[model samples]
Target: MAEIMLLLVFCLLIAAAVIFKEDRRVRDELRTQLTQRDAELADARDDARRQTAEAVRLKRLVVESGRSPAERRQLDEEWQRLVASDEVVSRMREAGLSPERLVTSAADVATVQPLLERGVTGEEIAQAVTASQALADAVSAQGSVSTLSPAELVRLAGLGQAAERSGKGEHDWPPIINLSEAAGYSFAVGSADLTPEFAERLRSKIAEEVVKIMGRYDAGVVEVIGHTDEQAMGKRESNLDRDLIPVLSGKTDIGTLSPADNAGLGMARAVSVARLFRTDPRFSNVTVIPLSGGQMVLPGDAVSDGSSARDARERRRIEIRVRRPEQPTQP
Candidate 1:
């Protein structure tokens, strides 16, 4: 009887151990399955959030595309107003154009679009518009307005790049310095060296303009500015922000020296022109300041680089203007 009781107790102990081990295995598997399900739910939520954001962006684009024509026309006039605002006009005069009126015509937009296309705005555009305009205005103001013949206006407009094509036409960069107005001389593309022909033309053309401005205004200084396209004259991989003065000098061989970028090229050209100005006895009466705009202003006052637009000829030209140092106010 005692032996039977012991065997039964042993069998019961073994059976209990097997049941406990099986329970643990099932519990572990259940916990793993739950963790995997939780991760999948989290991934699904993330995908849904991304889809919602993408849908919203597409919806906004659709709304913008449905704008009515009348709304667009109103926006156009508002755009025009922004361009003609007082701040813009004041900035324009500061840039050198004294506009008789503030309204922008179709031609104005045509002239303005190039600058607009190049991410130029507000005062920069105003300055270009005015500079190009002032170039025309200076020529027009030199003689009586009424006396300006049709042929002369046409010619002046062409050379000054003051022509206002319809805004709808293919956008083209106007000339910076009208070669026709500048005695038929222009710089070679991608070059700052003064050609023999360019040298002869500069001597005569600048002499005439300098005489006119000096006689008509209180100006006593002739500023010969060098402008260039955005193309570099130095290493393509170099930084443009660095100063090129170290490479340029009164005695440096300009032909051999590589200007780092547009600024260097423009300055070198301005210096070249300035050296020529010093040689002439007529320019001795006024101080000559050789300055560089360095692709700042384009033909027709639009802003661009050689890479930005295809109007290389105009962007690559030089300009001559009169500068009047401010006089001291009375105490």
Candidate 2:
């Protein structure tokens, strides 16, 4: 009876150990499955969040596209007004600047930021705008404008390339200088004679400015164009065809030569100026060409309406222009 009881206890112990091992294996499998399911659910949630964000962005784009251009512009202006600091808005108003009139381009914001921080005044802003408008007019007349922003110009100042252009019909041209005769640069009524004082001014002031401009643009040519009014030289004898060479060669004085018409007078004056430039060491490597604009172009480069007028001082001027040399095309 004692042996049978002991064997029964041993059998019970073995069965209990086997049952505990099987339960642990089943628990580990269940835990692993639960962990995998949790991982899958997290991934699904992330995907759903991304999709929701994308849908919201697309809906916003669709709404924006549905608005008219003017409405969109108004909204943009309103947004700009709202985002501007209260102090800035007040200062701008005090300075007579309309918030609606402020058109800030993406590139312009960087330029305007510092000005805003430093409290730019109305007068200064107006002056800047006026100067910008003048430049824009000049560029538009040339059929293209510079693509460089203020920041880019500052950076390129070191490279001697403050402005540049690309694409068809676009050009990076130097500014034209229309030197008025009334501004202390006047010549004699009918002669190409340049006074000592006027010559000195040309050499010192005008030449220096032209040299600076040339340094900036690296141009190779200088053109001196002479313009005259509708004043007719009444049947005066012209020795220009015979004496032009001698006058330019310094063999004969310009005073000895006579121009019969306005065209001859304009040509004579241009040649005199070109000679001065050619003799200057600063313009030695640069080609200086003399051109006669004659009396065909009006004060603002307008064509003559065949209306003859005498002693129009405003129409008498010397125009100086600079240009780069043309490159030869490859075969």
Candidate 3:
């Protein structure tokens, strides 16, 4: 009975040992599997991080490269072709989804279409037609391509066209002919009276060319400005030289006359000349405006230098200045 009890206790001890060994083997297997899973998880995280970094770098590269309008158009056409191709469609199906996300966004697509039709390029179009709003916004912010509005573009184009036309020698009107000498008419003498010799010379040369001058300039009006030297009538007094009124009165105080009074005398002289032109039918189209320079612009002296009669000839002079109709009207 004692031997049987000892054998039974040994059998119990063996069973317990076997049970403990099985538990240890199971724990070791579980620990190995957990270690393998942790390694796989770490590898997956590294690969995901690498792929995310690569994507971010590609996005940055796309944003940095500025594309031209021509390039943009080409990109648009190429994208459209790819989207329409069977290869893209098949790949999209294999991926278990439609290819909407891969396709260009509507706004970007719209921006590129017109540029493509206008002969823009692929890389340029790709820059504009990205899914990334930040990229698109960055490109748009550059203000190089899309800065000008449609109206501004049209206006600039028109100006360029006009400049080209001008360079090509297109003109709306004939070239103006500037007369070599002064126009209108003038006569110088000892008095305001018109000399017959002066009238005859004018009737021949000026009156004959009057029609030609009018037609050439398309002049609506003609102006005649007269100028004279500083000379006035001498004052009269009782008793000194009674019969010498002619010489003394001629030597009047020219400096004392006011501008208005001098201008009046000049106007009268111009009126006399105008009357001569008006009498003839050739000057019918000419409208005469009379003005005065008073003593401001003196006539050139016909006498030789150092002559005592310099003042005498200076007082006996007249002037004429011809101008176009478009000349600004002086106040």
Best by TM-score: 2
lDDT against the true structure, each candidate: 0.66, 0.81, 0.55
Candidates, ranked, TM-score:
2, 1, 3
* Model 3, span 37-133: residue lDDT tens: 9999999999999999999978855964677778867777886898788786897789885668547476866766898898888777666556456
Shift in Å, residue 72, candidate 2: 72
**Shift of residue 205 alpha carbon in model 3, Å:** 8.0
Candidate 1 C-alpha lDDT tens digits along 245-327? 43233444445435567776677677777777776888777787767788777766676544563446556666777656658
Name the lDDT value of residue 37 in candidate 1.
100
Model 1 pairs whose backbones collide: 175-299, 176-299, 230-306
Off by over 4 Å in 1: 1-184, 188-190, 232-253, 305-311, 328-331
lDDT of 2: 0.81
- lDDT-better candidate, 2 vs 3: 2
Ranking by lDDT: 2, 1, 3
What would the per-residue lDDT of candidate 2 be over residues 1-331, giving only the tens digit for each residue?
A: 9999999999999999999999999999999999999999999999999999999989977988999999889888987888777779899899998766675454666677788779997588779999989976765675433666667645755444424332111255677878768776777878898878778878888898888878777788899988888877888889989987777666887777688888888888887777788778999899888788889988777899868786778788888898888799999
Against the true structure, candidate 1 reaches a TM-score of 0.38
